[model samples]
Target: MRYPLLMRFLFLTFLLLCASLHADESPDTIAPIRERAMEHQKAGRFAAAVDDFIKCIEEGSKTNRTGRRAEYFARIAYNQTRMGNFKDARENMEKAPRQNGWKDEDPFLMEMRAIVFLATDQIEPALQIAQKFKAVNPKKAEYFEMVAQFFGGDEKCLATPLGRFLFDPEQLLYNGAVARNPKDLIARRRRAAYFLERANQQRFPNSYPAKIPVDRGGWAHLFDPATAAGLPYSFYASAFYDLSRALEMCSSQDEPFLRVRRAGAAYGWNAVAPKNSLFISAATIAGDLKRAQKQGALDVRTQRALGDFFSETLPPVDQPNYRPRLRSGIQSYSRALYFTRDESSLRDPDWLETPETDSLQKVRAARSTLIGFHLSGKPVALPDLPPLTELAWKDYGNTLVAREELGSALEAYKKALEFDPEFVPALNNIGTVYSRLGAFDIALEWFDKAVKADPKFAIGWTNRAGVLDELGDVEKSLASYDTALGIEPQNAQTWVSRGILAMNSKSWASGQNAFAQAARLAPQNSRYAALSAFAKFANENAELPKIDLSIEDKTWLSNFFGSDSLAESYASKGAADKVFAAREWIK
Candidate 1:
């Protein structure tokens, strides 16, 4: 009995030794490490993933699994590229084995090589690789080709039929992907982004006669004909639809960004052209025109055109049809805020402690990750959500402002400040709300804080100038206007405001110059033209120039001249100095 038991024990020991030896050469031995590496990659810890992938390659090499080792090498190279180690990525990519004795035949290896080439700005090689894989993986290949074309930035190439088909909104490649798979969040997001970019291009066409630069403050009242063209409602509607679908398909980690984007699209859809109103219409303006004519106001063909313009441009006189859409946007931003705030605790500690100066850089980094995922079919990790939370609150505040809920808008903006006290937009908006409420001193204080936070903020300076003007600090207001103009000379609205202040102060020459500049910047706006003419007449005591003044402008002048007929008589006589005496009523 003792000899039989010893024999059983020895047999078990021999089997265990053999199994251990087999494990060393089995692919299953690397499974745990591979899983860990994939987890690291999915979490955006590319450096850690690179190390694990290197270990996988080492283990695969021991098993003489050349194909598996090649895959591991490709993975390592991809992770290295994500980590911005381009040289290392290229070196590792070169280690991946050629398939069937052809270097470009292996789809996975080619993909890794193309990505590395793209990272290194080798657009031509990337394009070649993309073309080579066109038949093997058309979806990925098309994406690579599109990115290569974008990086190449060759106008001649983009003007070609193939390039137009690739980049044009009507023929976008993502449209096909989404059509094939409605649940493809990446395709939906990309299509939505494409529509938005197209809408922006339409809103600010390159062929526009006057190119008014967009202001830093993003103030809504800037007068630019290009902006007046407005983004087509259909574009935003399409974008909103795709974004809504993406939201339905996206994971919880992606919900915040998608929600924010959807909210923005909703806002754009609600705010675009074809003004919604229950009261104001062409009929109302026509009736008003008849009354003016009965009162002997000089009614001309331009008056009808002005009425049409007003009918089209004016905000709804009552609650708009799009209020529910604005409310929906508000709800989306609220949900985004909730998700971001709840997930903040899970963010890297270093991100939470990032300095205010680095906030923009962090946002750019998050955007770059998104761009990479969009172009390369890479899985993006959850980006830092806190910086975006501030944007959520600011945009929420803006929607509330659009809804005319000033009190709620203040609360939303204050919430934004809670996330980032130095957030310039929130601070500027708070000041704007206060100015609208007639609390000039408090508004000035907030504007001061905004400009102090970022001296280069032109909008903050402009807001400060307006508040100063209201508070009778004319010199300081003018200086602030000068600073804002120095920052953004193409801001026509600022020029108009500065001109109005100049005229009120009886600085006639300066008023004329500012008004002329505004008119030069916004040539399509007849209101600016009229203002310039009036300023010129007032400054030089010259004959009144022929300018198309809107009905509202004529009414303003009528109020000043004591009657519509008297104002017309003064204009007919070029008695501009007499008209200039009514400058006190300018505002």
Candidate 2:
């Protein structure tokens, strides 16, 4: 899977032509050493290849192909790895700078160092280097997988962020640095991670709120054992994982809903500990009222209002089921209305006039807001919005974003922020829209605002890292990526993005490794597969497949993503040439 093999071959030919086009050095002077290194690398004499490439780099100093020099260093690092010189390879490859032109240094050399370290039972260093590489390019899937393997797979590592919850109350899921869980939590975690990954990948669809990652047994099913009992154990396992995440959120905040959820879980589990006990029904309301009173000033009124809202809103039950839930929802809503002036608008006559009127009015308002803000590129007014607790704005914002009416989406998001100035999603969506509009600086501002709002938001960190990479702020991008992976190591998209950035950095060896990771994380992604092949071929210095300008290639470029330039380029020179030439411009 090296650099779409066809693209690789064409790129090599292009590179060769570029070399010939420039009279900096005779082919004879450089070719012999390069060919020798290629031979050694091909025959598995990696050490020999390293030596030859090193010499070639020194000899090429008379020329100004810093890119070429970097490429050689990268390849040498790859060769050193086969010879088991992991430390040296890593040290040397780190010196390579990103190419100014199209040249990429050996993409997989650093990846190999980390890979081989793991193969040699060097877990700690492998993890560290792997994390470093991923931060530079988080899109590499294989690298992420390798890192996960070292930590006992996805589920085992979920415990890293919440050791107490994921590993059991006593943290007994692992023994002396190895996973002790036999239920295959690792694989389950990986599967569950995909739900989140896909949710993120869907790019906030244009109609419905982008799909939510709902796990029946995980967070989705944590409410009742009866619901979980209907599903397979695996379903429950994933649900538990989500529940753990939800609980983690609760532990970090004093959110009333989360607290209620905890009380519910405790009630469901019926654990004897006081912390594990829960109150439901009227008792739940009483508890909320008590908390409000303790905080002072109209807290009691707010709590009672919530109880009234719940009593009116809760659906009639044939039996006494879901009492706790009703109480929780009511209390939650009451707090929302009590906290902010903006949310008070939810009590507007348009909404309270009738249920149908409320629904339709809200939807129209959301649409108008999104259109006004994002499409029109107007500054959002933060005044006269709903309260943060109402969550009306979040709901409306998500609705508009789903419709692909980015302008409308922006407004809805802006309005949400007016309600909750510290809301993460509002900040995130605003940044996304700004990025779409090529307003990178403004996007960075919103993303920065999101990070400031909730430092624990992994998605914010990852997306911000992506913006930084796009802006060519490689060092800062790497730092942001580190923050993301540290928060959510299982995010495959982050791995892939990291990989792409690494490749673009002109450290060919590192790029190749990053691509490998991207491919592994998303095996079905054609881009990842193509890049993987390209990276491998580039490192080998072997002939790449000629780009076929055939109808098929044309269709792939034109019909698929409307890549007319790419199709034309491929038609004239080859697919590889077209891909390389169009890579930056296409996206």
Whole-model lDDT per candidate: 0.59, 0.48
Model 1 stretches astray by more than 4 angstroms? 1-388, 542-556, 559-587
Q: Which candidate is the best by TM-score?
A: 1
Cα lDDT of model 1 overall?
A: 0.59
Q: RMSD in angstroms, all models?
A: 28.8, 28.6
Model 1 per-residue lDDT tens digits across residues 10-88: 9999998886677655657688999999887765456678889888777766764444677787888877655435567
The estimated TM-scores of all candidates read 0.30, 0.28
